[model samples]
Target: MTDDSSRAFVPGHVTGFFSVHEADDPEQAGSRGAGLTLSEGVTVEVEPAVETSMQLNDEPAAIEAVTRVLGDLGVEARVTATTDLPIGAGFGVSGAAALGTALAANRTFDCGRSENELVTIAHTAEVEAGTGLGDVVAQARGGVPIRLDPGAPEYGRMDGVPARSRVEYLTLGERSTEEVLAGNTDRLSEVGVDMLVRLVEKPTLPTLLASSRKFAREADLLTPGVEDVLEDVADEGGEAAMAMLGETIFALGNGLTRAGYDAEACEVHPTGATLEMD
Candidate 1:
């Protein structure tokens, strides 16, 4: 029962700190972290086709997460995704694409899967692809998500920062998520565990930022550019830290601008992924 077409939008997510968890089951392999959902993100379109194909921003490409979703759902379709955020910049672009594709494909193929099932499929695909850990769950719930436990939508537990504020970011360059995820992560994981515990106890944006700064320093994830930007922000009485696995910096309110950066700005999106009905 193929439909005419389908579309979905998923918010980009920026994780401040996280600890890795792995399992034989992909659904159970996720990270415990805190992150914010962005007002800007990816929009995906699905159309029935003879063979499964995909394009990102009109360029023919192969995204592991998207391919995994299509294979899992057993559907052949043309998937197109467009986003303003730079790929591999810690904005969860791959996770967003996977979630968007899953949501759109489910409708296009008339699959009777529930929302939980869709999230599970996407989360598993992201984990298997090594593109992300907690992004799927955070994007699934939106807002400032605090992932307290690791897993898929069904297995993972989450809470969020209650207050919303404008978020600003500066993208210095791309960092391969897969490469970082594959490397030694002992120190980073330890710092992430500590930060997650602190956040769960307090559950506030200020705590998230403060913990992020410490994690960046303790985990040694901060690049020269990120460190310089962070210092500048601190001098200006603003809080800033490196986005996980990317040469990017994110801060609260107008922190980036106040630090003399021409950064991109967006609000804290209150919702997660959604199918565009109209």
Candidate 2:
């Protein structure tokens, strides 16, 4: 028998997803922003962690997603993680965990699925989990992601997205994704969706981010100290914005370093997941 077992750490993302564009129109979530990584990837390893207990609301969805991958690869495994950030906090925890599980399963079973393939699996898991939309794409291809249209799942990866940008996140306790969204129907606007469509189609994220940030403010999702922090980042010569659900805010700018912001006051995490090979 083959020794199939590996570990992968999927990073967490910020809030800011209104809706996925439907067949007839664009989708958007203007009242949110996601930021910072907590140095903890959604770690998934091989070796069948056995009868693990998951504390998430959608245990069935998460379990089913992992089980399907295991069945496809003919392997066994166990998984666990913290459920600190509630769903709809604008943090891409669900997507990150699903991505981590997929990668970990592949490594554990030697399934040989590509990055894109893993993204597809993660996306399916998100839909099943009912956490949010476009999470798979956000977790897989991060850094100011702009998905212009919906239904087709076509996204553009903008190079130099962080060329003149720096992102920071603040953990303002915890909030429910559903509650935030319930209170944030006004943030999603038609013009913003159209602009997102244009930006994604042309693949201009940095420029479009400026407008996106503005729309976020109009939607009343910006958290306390967010505008102040953004101003500080702007003073240092960069563009700043709040992320998914006001859970965190990121400041993007040219020559912006970690020193420019108060990292001690916030949770800082890199963009992306990690891999653990046994």
Candidate 3:
């Protein structure tokens, strides 16, 4: 009924992603020029408290965003979780956190917002935070996401990479989402929007992802190493592409085999994030 309600929840997560159509430079990505859905299967925990106190890193913006959404719903709860990843590494960390909080807080108050509604709220928070152009949508709706228009911020679900595809990911490092978004507005344009629309309508999901990856490389967002890695993987009988921003890259194609990639090279993750009540 209110923030005082005693309940909790945790949700699942996956690293779904929305592709970027052009090159992102320092002037655009602010040092972290790509976007992605970070760690998936994130676990969120909630507990009933006299008042709502969200415990997380210094993401007051996220706290504020969730609080505002919860306030609108007249529900509240104690929110806490693992040290959240950077805001923008192209991972849906922001959406995961928001959705996790919403799921947790929903139980705390016995509120009944549907998953769709919660996702909508999370998207609003992401917009308010300005960490992503469409990470919320991809995170919320999983799978390969294709945003036809960055202006209206509209997108739709895309099929996963083909089952027979051979690919793996490589982690580069970490970067803050906020820092990456700091100077990216100039790169956002109608042309990028059109490119996304075309990709989404591609005959196959794999084709769509491959094309988008090429576009990213042509735009110069994909570093030499990143491009080299992709080329190596693809030439080695696999297709490799940047995952989210730069923190990681995933290889895709018919010839890729799990054995082809070094398990020790990078951590494998479920495709989405999750939350739960303890």
Alpha-carbon lDDT, every model = 0.90, 0.51, 0.47
Model 2 agreement with the true structure over 135-238: per-residue lDDT tens digits:
55655554544444332133323221342234444454555554544453543644456445545455443555565566567666566666766676667766
lDDT of 3 by residue, 77-171 (tens): 56665543433444455556666666666666667877666656665665555544455445554444344333212233333332222234455
- Tens digit per residue, CA lDDT, model 1, 1-278: 12588999999999899889989999999898898899999999988889989999889989899999999999998999999988888999999999999999999898889999999999999999889998988998989999989999788988888989999999999998888889988888999999988988888888999999899889888888889999999999997878887988999999999988999999889999999984
TM-score-based ranking: 1, 3, 2
Model 3 / residue 254 / CA error / Å: 9.6
What TM-score against the true fold does each predicted structure earn? 0.97, 0.65, 0.66
- Tell me the spans in candidate 2 whose CA falls farther than 4 Å from its real position: 1-4, 15-18, 22-41, 54-76, 80-89, 110-114, 142-144, 151-166, 181-191, 197-209, 231-238, 253-261, 264-276
Which order, best to worst by lDDT? Answer: 1, 2, 3
Best-performing candidate as measured by TM-score: 1
Look at candidate 1 and give me any clashing residue pairs: none
Better of 1 and 2 by TM-score: 1
Each candidate structure's count of clashing pairs: 0, 34, 39
Candidate that beats the other on TM-score, 1 or 3, i.e. the better one: 1
| Top lDDT prediction, candidate number | 1
